[model samples]
Target chain A: MSELLSAEIQNCIEGPVVKYGYLSEQIDVVATPQSGLTSSTTGNRVMTDTISEAQNPKSFLLAIEALERGL
Target chain B: MILGLFVGESFAELSVAESTPSSRGTLREHQRWYLPKHGLKAYLQNWLTKTPHKPERVIVSSRFLYKLAGHRLGGSVAQIVTSGFENWSHFASLPANTRSTSLRQLNRCPSLSSQDLIFAVHERILSDGSIGKPLDLSEIGAIHEKLQVLGLKKVCLHFHNSNLNSIHQQQTRDFLVTLGYEIFEPPVVDAFPSLEPFTRWKTNTLSAAVSGTFEESMKEIFEGLSAQIKEEQIFFFDGDLRLHQGEPLYRLSSLFALEACLYSQLSKIMNTKMKSEKPLTFLHFGIEHFSYLTDEKTLTESPWGTLALGTQGCRDFSIQPSSLLDLHDDGSLVTKGNLSYEPGPIHLGRGHKPLVADLLIQETKWPEIIDLDEKQARTSLDRWVLLMQTWQRSVKKLRFLANLLSVCFEIK
Candidate 1:
């Protein structure tokens, strides 16, 4: 790693760390690209999953439709 | 009998319509139906007779029945139920054992907090008693501490805003690391991930041109460019243009002048290329974003959430024609209408008159018609241009590296 990146990482690690809720397992990798590619990919995947789930049988969409139809 | 009224698959066929004027008409039109005390119907044999175009079904769930009950019971009964009390006064007069059980039953019913409670109770009734309680901050800290003690190698710390710089956060990080936890800090990429470098370059160039006195700045920029690249060759100019510091009018005028300069330069380049043996080339330029700082006190309090700025500054400069005002300037801006008149020159900082005058300066050159010293102008332009070129090359490299990484990933 370059000296600049190394220094930045050190700063981040030694800097103030806010403790949130715990996770059961340790993360294997940490990817933080300077770009929005990862964020975009993750967002698209989530949206696709949500749409597919909504279209599935026994989904919330079905429940809402049944309620509307007085079923 | 009430259970029988609700029982069977056919019970779902019951259409409950509120006794509104529109629904009353529908009820009268569809004669073959039994209307309950709350104007509910057992069936509407030909409900679609009135509006054939709109075949919409209205479902009245159990919540409607609860609302109907509240309406019939009046305000006092509704208030008693909300206060977590038994509706009937006779319940208090019952035997001790009977009263105790009756009180327990009343308390077991969901408490009403708002009018929406009628509908909320339906969901509550359907759901199993397995709702999770919101986790407290103390509980979260304890869990994090436990994870650290377990010797977890990788952990993520998420916080909003300046909270990351707090002592508590620092202490937590230290505690985790001291316990042998390896906090995960992702590698940072050097270049902008979203916008193309050319877009960023053009924006910076335009911003610099409009940030100050146009002719002087441009002359300086071109002079600086003379050292690194020939004046005849196509080149890029880049520098920090602190455009927001001055008055809004001046800032806007600077932008207009820069636009005119760029258009002229682009036309010249295209004309030259047309005469030469070289293929046609295009120069793409755009500003991604721009921001300015203003005194917080200047913002007027708006009843409608949005804050307004007083138009007194613009009105003071109203001597200039309205045609000069930029698209951002509101033509219908109303003055605060204060009657007091001060002696000094009116504050034109808030107005578009400066911008209009500056735009005129682009063509007329009224103030200083003569251009700056060629050598001095060249020196300044050269430095800015070189800086811009260096940044552009760096951005290009970063883009290449990103593409290489993606290609490598594809191969893998």
Candidate 2:
């Protein structure tokens, strides 16, 4: 398994590098659990909704005040 | 070194899997959503999971595709001005034949045509007094056949507007039902009592204050806000809305609102005397485009107070918050979420100009200094234009990807 893995890495490194410039040559790839990746999509959705309210001048002022309260 | 080895092994496996006929066939179909000539899929499917009986393909209308390609609804009037047209009158006075000839010449130069300025102007005029054509029944049938071949027994069809009020949309929905495909209709919720009045008042008041017509932009913004307010109200009123309807009360609304609604509804179920025998599956459509749930630290720093409302409401309902969806922007999709990747902050790059310094320089004794200031201003303006163009292109690409992904998901 170790030999096979090393050969795979060697093959990848030997392939043509296109966009990443120098980093492509020096790149190290790692695999981790799926949970390691963090996503902010949910937070942004909420922010979009909250900001939508700010379209109104009254809501705009309130939004500013709300922001000042820091969350 | 071990990590790199593991990654290489994984990549090899991925390549083998992707090279399979099934994967290649799907890729071919997906490429239709992007520039056909490029043969690239509009969206990265890194985060997509194929589940049976769910939507496998989302077909966006040509109208949206035009917009994604940087053709605005009102044409490139703003762009025309930036390209040195003094005003609307100046653009209008240029003979149509001459303008067309010049546009054709400009098209020959790839750099000048990169923005699709000529196509936008032509499309605007052509689509005047008419909405762009809708997808026909034949197109829908073709997509259905493709999904059927892929062994998808049923697929969910979604339109951006759930009302299905448009003649074309209604006809499409009717045709799909005839073909025995289950249509996923987003639940209708009542708007908050204050929503309409508030939106109307704001629009009317702001229209007067602003110089040009603000109604168009403000109207769209208010309509969206009204829809969100309705979703929130439904979440507050209907505890069993998701379960009863077989869908979340709000699917495409704001992430914060969706989380709050889900948490509240789930809490009600948890606290009830009667227990549900089976686990409830909540469908969060188009959630991957939104921000992830706010972390405790970030929540406190957020300017939107409604975020707090969502957090507090969840707590009150005894719902423990969880990361519901992964954050995948267009750049992240391309990079595959590289740890070292940091998007350049477009907003922060806009530096402030000092009016006081400019005034002083203009009144100064040194004429050469004034010339220097003018040169600097011109340079800054050029830079600003370039940045704006880049930002607009990025935004259009991201929007296109998001729309494509939302329209279609794979069935595994």
Candidate 3:
């Protein structure tokens, strides 16, 4: 099967991608996934809920501290 | 007679068409300049009175179309939340695409409420449908006075645990309404009551911020055409392009960049340049180039944050408004993400700056809008590019088919 995909997107897909000219088969192409990046929406560093709380405080007073301290 | 009243940023047009069993017959359209001071309703009322046949139903797409088109709410909106959750909207529920994303570059996406306007009043509802803290009715007068002084009429209330216990929100809403204020209904709070608080808060607040403007615009269009058609007969479209009857929009944020929704729909039916046997991704190239989403994602599933929220899902998209600069030395194009709309008549020879259209279409041919000098447009662009080139170190020039899409990257 043929796929008209961007090289940027193709760099991210993990599985083997085959490029064929209409009916021609056996043209095997492997998609090498981009290094140092997860395919999932969530990143490698999943901050805990408490950390998120520090990141976005409920109180404006807490936010002042969150900003200076680099929450 | 079936009619469509389209209210745009600059002008409003009323289109009358005869709908047939098989085809849409010829359309007799009348264009009217949108003059807010004179009142849209009166203009519409005058126009409708002149029509030979009574208008059965009019689909009036209001001035909110401008806000939706450019993701800019007309007026400032104030948001009231549970005392603790003052910065609730700052925590959008959008997912992170990559680890490498720099926080500096990661913009705090389309915020509806002004930071100064977000008021945290004394009110709290526990998750168990219990009122932890009752509504502080005392806070109402001061808030109302502040609103009045600022000329800010619209207010959105989002209390913590509002889903389980809406007493505080209702009380606040009532209190705010008594003060001659336009209280906006929280987004999706009625329908999706169990949404995660962060997502819920962001969604509700964004809608709250834009809803007042949306309502006002709708009111202008509807009131103008109210003499001709019933309120129920008036129709509007969500971002998914699904026709909905009357207001209290399903997902207001989805309506941002409404034309992108149309483009999303068009991408589905429009034949692609590259025909492939397997699943294929589509890329659209025009004056301003854009890559369309995957096929499955194109279908109208959930259009909540389609345009407004600058969510970097799997991809982060940017917009460059009018005026493309040239990397003259390399014969490449360069532009920054202005994301501006109909960037004020520059190409029409009104604005001081020179737009891309001015460079290409000027003198060569007279466009839809006239009164332009091509030579001057090129000179202005050349001067602007020279000014920008001195500071901007990195520039990306993309060649697609024959056209060059020059995009300048922000390096911090």
Residues B347-386, model 1: lDDT tens digits: 1112212222222222332222213345633554454345
Scoring only chain A, what TM-score does candidate 1 earn? 0.20
Looking at model 2, give its docking quality level.
Answer: incorrect
Please identify model 3 stretches exceeding 4 Å from their true place: A1-71, B4-17, B22-56, B60-76, B89-111, B127-131, B134-152, B189-199, B219-233, B240-254, B257-332, B342-346, B354-412
- Return the lDDT, model 3, position B82: 75
- Model 1: residues >4 Å from true position, as ranges? A1-71, B1-141, B148-151, B185-412
- At residue B322, give the lDDT of candidate 2: 10
* Model 1 residue B327 distance off true place after TM-score fit, in angstroms: 48
Highest TM-score among the candidates is held by which one? 3
- In candidate 1, position B331 carries an lDDT of 26
Q: Give model 3's docking category.
A: incorrect
User: In candidate 3, which residue pairs clash?
Assistant: A58-B84, B41-B224, B333-B406
> Is model 1 an incorrect, acceptable, medium or high docking prediction?
incorrect
For all the models shown, what interface RMSD does each have? 27.3, 25.9, 20.4
lDDT at position B231, candidate 3: 77
